[model samples]
Target: MNSVRYTWPEGKKCAVVLSFDFDGITPYLWRSRHSQSKGISEKEQRRFGPRQGIYRILELLEKWEIKGSFYIPGVTAEEYPQAVEAIAKCGHEIGLHGYLHERVDELTRDKIEETLIKGKAAIEHIVGQRKMGYRSPSWEMTEDTFEVIKKYEVLYDSSLMGADHPYWINQMVELPVQWLLDDAIFYRYVGGGASVNPPANPATVIDTWKKEFEGIKKYGGLFMLTMHPWLSGRGSRILALESLISYLKMDSEIWWATAQEVAAYHQSLEVEGKNACLTEMIDR
Candidate 1:
């Protein structure tokens, strides 16, 4: 027999989860849009500085005929409630990204608890739902974050690059932290990481993304990509972002649901202990 034994989620058609993280709906960057961000360090400010990025993301989703998840911070909702309304009106899922998009590196357990609680309250008050998903900033999660997530009863967390597929949370496997993310691949991260520039050209980003998308098609699984409204909100990058949508529209078999839908489906299957079929079907 071949030594390359396939695990549970091998070659499955993927279920793509298009997730937008903190700073999108929030107007924290509204001022930056008007003038050059002065004095502030590039790394420190870029995280929250994307006022128009939201509009561009909305346009991209509409073009793709896809619905996405928006994980906003508590301060974001408290600050820009109109964007919260717009997100709901546009028919997208809203999740929590904490109160200020603060990373675990900078917080203690008490602070994380305080911020997360505030974030949930602000999002629910504005978006009209107890947000179901949570993503830590920069995927820089601490041990405390997990305990807090479990405490809040979040359906799933998407900040980790732990797998190439959406494994059942708490199920324990070598899997992707996020099923789809645009940060490292498209958006530039500090320290000149992969996000600094995608491995290929702007046009190629979609091509590579589609290659992954096609893998999901075969396997019947999910694709989770991250994007920032600031960069993709304008210029040639718009074409780059839109191309993925253009390609996704070609396939009708794909179900463009929120992260909640996927997590719920998998969790329910696991609870009833019908995981074998679910796994095989998801793996396609």
Candidate 2:
């Protein structure tokens, strides 16, 4: 196996990124686009995100004095403009998710392009600036998606899990994420046919997060935590997140940053022709 030991800003041992997918009810609408059922239960569950979960998350970040990256769909932004405005006003980074939380793998290249343009425009209109990053809906990506990503000149993508840290994918930086670090997998229980099991205990989930952060720090890489307001915004879950942040704060070697900041720092490194490539190893 071969790897490159990337150096973080200020010679920090590991970079920590707190990112949120502020999906609201966009994902539900997308999934039920073809269904005739007028189910209000699931829709209301998802709405909890924009209505209350997001604000709780914002408060948590403010308490910690750290900025976070929020990826929101166009429909979500349009539906919850106040939430989007509050995020921007709080000085956090907002990135495009999709036009309707549409999965890139299910759409054609043209459709993907359409989503990108609309999503970007919708978010930029509220935030009053160009968005610098994107996280594919459902973390589904394809070559077609990458093409549109380049077309828009997005600085980074958080959908890929190719590496434990940020790496170059052509001209864009890939701020990789893992399933274990995402709260949706653990806490997203919408009930009915969509939900499979009960939500995991927040304590259990926090233990896993703490372990992963320690491992990432020990190995010197990025600790990118992907969370959803609908899932992690609950009171108990928020407390658990607070505990995790407190644990991480005890470490002085961690460079806390938003995804865009990490990507910008990674881009500044001359990975192609300099000592920025800290280590490379190959095993037979």
Candidate 3:
């Protein structure tokens, strides 16, 4: 818990960031690097994201007039340029997710840096600008990942789970996330995989998210939701997201923002000397 409460813009009690990892066929290819050309079934399943899932998710965001942060792999962006371009056209923030949804921890430092550069270039090619944020493919980052991202001058990262609120890491802001708030844990299932967990009830998952939001509001912290278009864009599951959004909007005290917006706001607070106590928490 924060010893001192931090203030939010417009007198809002808490901040919320709705983030989506637009992983198309990259995850499947990453899992089976040798089967890229032969993994027809797996590839097609994952392709649902670019083919239909992203459109559905985009429609929901548009209907609610909300701008989300989308983390796209270089492969996904390259393979689905039209989908990526549409996301940009909708005024959503694009962030780097990796070159092929590769886990950074498993890569060497040089590989990590290379992937970051490639991923940024791919997104830039589609969005016409460099992304200001990053989220690791599997919430796994190497010790050198931060340094690599810093070299790129990325403004923030959403992969770490160090805290409930945004904090500085080296030269970048870290908007932390937890598995409990991620939609994948509740819905993702792989056939014939070791330790397969069945999907949880959508209503129960939404209730849990609402409870998390209420607690953040009580403490004036940030609520960051990590979602995957492939997992949560289904008709039945999307209803939970819609309900959660509607419920949150019923209260005017929540500051709904994209990850970049929250990062910029935190930076502004530091510049104004209003974030001294918050920075102290990070130091501790």
Candidate 4:
């Protein structure tokens, strides 16, 4: 397979971006089509994210002195301004995650633009600065979504799984994400009419993550971990995240960064007219 040879800051072997999707109750309401009565239980379940899970995650990141990228929906920020404020105050990067966690593929062009504007404004209000990154709700984006994001001048997007390395998406840097690296695939569970999947073993999840990091280290690529506070903030699962953070920190060669930092670095290289070399590698 084709590979990309990229150099991280300080000549690090690999780059790792720790990110969280702070959806809160917006996803539940969006999935239920604003039918709060039908999704009350689900909404409350997701409410744990803003109420408790985010605090736990924030505390963990603070303890490690690691700043993470947090994507928040407009409605989530509006409803829980204090929680959003706390994240910004912690020196973490906040990115856009939509106005109500609406799937971009399902919305029209106008709706997409509207949500993008509203989401950006809401996050900017809390962070007191313009957000430069965006991760589509549910990791689903339409073709028009690209145009919409560009119209808003978003610096980078993390919704695509095209490659493990950072690549260009028109004017925006594409910091790719993968399902295997997302915590929702392992920990999402809901009752009633909502879909449910069996949670994976925390040990196995962390083990897989460690192996992924090893691969990135070998190839000198970017490793983006997509997690949600509600899913990974549970008592047991949070331990796995803490362990993973500790493991990554043990290696001084790993360049830890937020999504915005990664994007800026890539942009700097592009402006310098430097190209990342593509090579083929054989696994031993």
In order of appearance, the predictions have TM-scores of 0.76, 0.94, 0.95, 0.92
Clash counts for all predictions = 36, 0, 0, 0
lDDT of 4 by residue, 71-177 (tens): 99999999899999999899999999999999998999999999999988887777777747889999987779999998878888999886677877655688989
* CA RMSD (A), model 1: 6.0
Worst 10 residues of 1 by lDDT: 2-11
Which stretches of model 3 miss by more than 4 angstroms?
Answer: 34-39
Which pairs clash inside model 2?
none
| lDDT (tens digit, per residue) of candidate 2 on 1-284 | 65456677777999999999999889888988998886799888888899999999999999989999999999999999999999999999999899999999899999999999999889888887774798999999898888889888887888988778777665567889999999988998888878898999999999999999988987788999999998899999999999999999999999999999988877777444543344221110
Query: What lDDT does each candidate get?
Result: 0.64, 0.88, 0.87, 0.86
Backbone clashes in model 4:
0
> Residue 175 error for model 3, in Å?
0.7
**Residue 251 of model 3, lDDT score:** 92
Q: How far off is residue 131 in model 3, in Å?
A: 4.1
Each candidate: RMSD to true structure? 6.0, 2.4, 1.8, 3.4
lDDT, candidate 2, equals: 0.88
- Residue-wise C-alpha lDDT for candidate 1, range 94-181, written one tens digit per residue: 8778776777767899898988888898888876666477877666777788778778777677766644555544432212444334
